[model samples]
Target: MAALEAEIARRPGHNIKRAEQALMTAKAAVLREFELTVPQYAGMVVLSYLPGTSGAQLARICAVTPQTMATVLSNLEAKGLVTRTPSSVHQKVFVTKLTRAGNALIKRADVKAHAVEDRLVAEFSDDERRLLADLLERAIKVLNG
Candidate 1:
């Protein structure tokens, strides 16, 4: 245990990755109740927020490859949670939108997800939460660059 703690203290990236993995695990467990995977739930959430989004755009937003997004979109479609219609501007492009059922499912899932998030940051003040978000975003931007 001390060794693990020492390693974590020495590597911020490793610590962040471990935290992310733990969060994903907890989220997966919550999503399981709705028969959804983490990727599926993320796709649904994005679709709910941005109706008529393209699969490619969704892939970027979800930080998954286009091929992976295709699979996730397929699963969501099979579950009747989303629909894809050919874009009016581009016949070759397909636009995705959540169905009423998808919207409902995401709403419930959001509640559960928020509960998990709240618990994770329960000790932090509002300012601390905002600061953490800003710092994470800056790190992501640097890494992406």
Candidate 2:
């Protein structure tokens, strides 16, 4: 562990490069199955988390601004993949739902991404996965704060 950490300290670019590679790999796989960019795919994944989740909530979850979420929603809706309705929870708020096509797309993306995700974290145990996720969440908070 110490040796690896020392090496990583000297070659710090590996961290960012690996992250980018993973993103690119996932993007390529998704593109093969659906016509969505990385950000659009991210929005779709966020939408899948809760079918009726508000766009503003999704924007926060996906670390994007509301306007970017709106654009992504526009593209997804145009493709007949999602539906937006005036929220009963709030008069002016719109809740987004994945349409049949959107559900199907998310499922397909899951299958396509499995290999890449597995490769990325194959070394982690269940506990390690949890810790890694927690640490990354913390880092995101620190960086974005």
Candidate 3:
């Protein structure tokens, strides 16, 4: 623990990366119980909020390459959780939506995911959580810019 703290103190990015890894590990564990990968889970969550989104849009939103998103969508389609249809507005575009099965699975998965989140934040006050979120967002914005 002391060595880890010392290393992270020397490189702050290590702290952020480690935190992200831990969060992803926890999420993956919960998601696995539902037979979903992290990307698939993320895609479904996005679809729940924005139904009929384009594959390109989902790829951007999920921070994955278009090819990776295509594979994720294909896997979800094979699992009968989502469907992709040719867009009426764009002949070459395919829009994706969560099927009823996807909706139900996500609803259940969210409960488990939220439990992991709640456990992660259990030691923090509400204000601290907000501050952490803001700082993370700012770091992302700076890195992106």
Question: What TM-score does candidate 3 reach?
Answer: 0.90
Alpha carbon deviation, residue 6, candidate 1 (Å): 3.0
lDDT of 3 by residue, 23-128 (tens): 8899999999999888899899999999999889999999999999999999999999999999999999998999999999999998898898899999799999
Most TM-score-accurate candidate: 3
* C-alpha lDDT (0 to 100) for residue 36 of candidate 2: 74
Rank the models by TM-score, top first: 3, 1, 2
Q: What is the lDDT ranking, best to worst?
A: 1, 3, 2
List TM-score per model, in order: 0.90, 0.73, 0.90
- On a 0 to 100 scale, what is the lDDT of residue 30 in model 3? 95
| TM-score winner, 2 or 3 | 3
Q: Each candidate's lDDT (Cα)? A: 0.93, 0.81, 0.93
TM-score of candidate 2 versus the correct structure, residues matched by position:
0.73
Measure candidate 3: CA RMSD.
2.2
Candidate 3 residue pairs in clash (backbone atoms < 3 Å): none
lDDT for each residue of candidate 2 in 1-145, tens digit (9 for 90 to 100) = 9998889867635786787777777767656667776667777787777779888998888878999999989888999989999988789899899998988998787666666778778878999999989987887788679
